[model samples]
Target: MTEIVFTPIGTVHSPFSDPRDMPIQPVGARGVRGTIELDPACAAGLQDLAGFSRIIVLYHFHRSNGYSLEVVPFLDKTPRGVFATRAPRRPNAIGISMLRLIAVDGATLTVEDVDILDGTPVLDIKPYVPAFDAYPDERAGWLTTTSGAARTMRSDDRFC
Candidate 1:
């Protein structure tokens, strides 16, 4: 395997300090607001981003300290491979979430529906294009059954 490196483009600011109390998915976090403080050098990247109602934030689960190939996810009772679930404990502690864009003020972006913990390191941001990103009929395998619980689900410290 080859080693790859990335610097944080920004830090995510959210109300949840403890991962245990945070929403497990954007659906559960609807209307929950937050902010992203980007480095000034990356301010130019914010241009025209306001046109997007939502953006996919690729971030590092900086607080995740370990990796496990198999573990029980929050919504399941049985163990599953890490790749099969969105559990933060993975080979790479990378996280992605689609958050509503409330406003973009230079390098600072006010957002909503955030599920990530506060101070998470943002790897990149991309506009969410419904035509290119949505998949209404896609099969989710184990996720299909699990995602149904999202409406009432909130994360606990099982992964943390």
Candidate 2:
């Protein structure tokens, strides 16, 4: 296998220091505020990011220790294949969330609807254009049946 590496552009600062009570998804984190403290070296990349209302954040699941091929996700009781659930314990330990962009101040970004944990390393950020990221008719498999549970669900120690 080929080796790959990444350097985080920033770190997320959120109200959630512990995963036990955190939102399972962005929808559940509505109105929650957070900040991204970008490294000074990456400050120039923020130049045009303020124009977008939403941004997609790709980050490292820093605290997730290992992987499980199957997991009982926070929103469901049945164990499912890891790939089928949004459980953070994965081979890559990467996570993505689309958050509301509130403001950009030099190397710092103020955002809302943040579901990420505090101090999570941000791998990358991209403007969220609905035309490219949205697919209202897309099938979500098992999620189609259990997604409603996400609204009231919170992260637990199961995946920790």
Which residue pairs show backbone clashes in model 2? none
Please estimate how well model 2 matches the true structure, expressed as its whole-model Cα lDDT: 0.94
- Candidate 1 off by > 4 Å: none
lDDT of 1: 0.93
Give me the displacement of residue 17 in model 1, in angstroms: 0.6
Instruction: Report the number of clashing residue pairs per model.
Output: 0, 0
* lDDT values, one for every candidate: 0.93, 0.94
75-111, model 1: which lDDT tens digit per residue? 9999999998899988999999999999999899999
- Backbone clashes counted, model 1: 0
C-alpha RMSD in Å of predicted model 1 compared with the true structure: 0.8
lDDT of 2 by residue, 19-97 (tens): 8889999999999999999999999999999999999999999999989999888877889999998899999999999
Report how far residue 101 has shifted in candidate 2, in Å.
0.2
Candidate 2: regions farther than 4 A off: none
- Cα-based lDDT at residue 44, candidate 2: 97
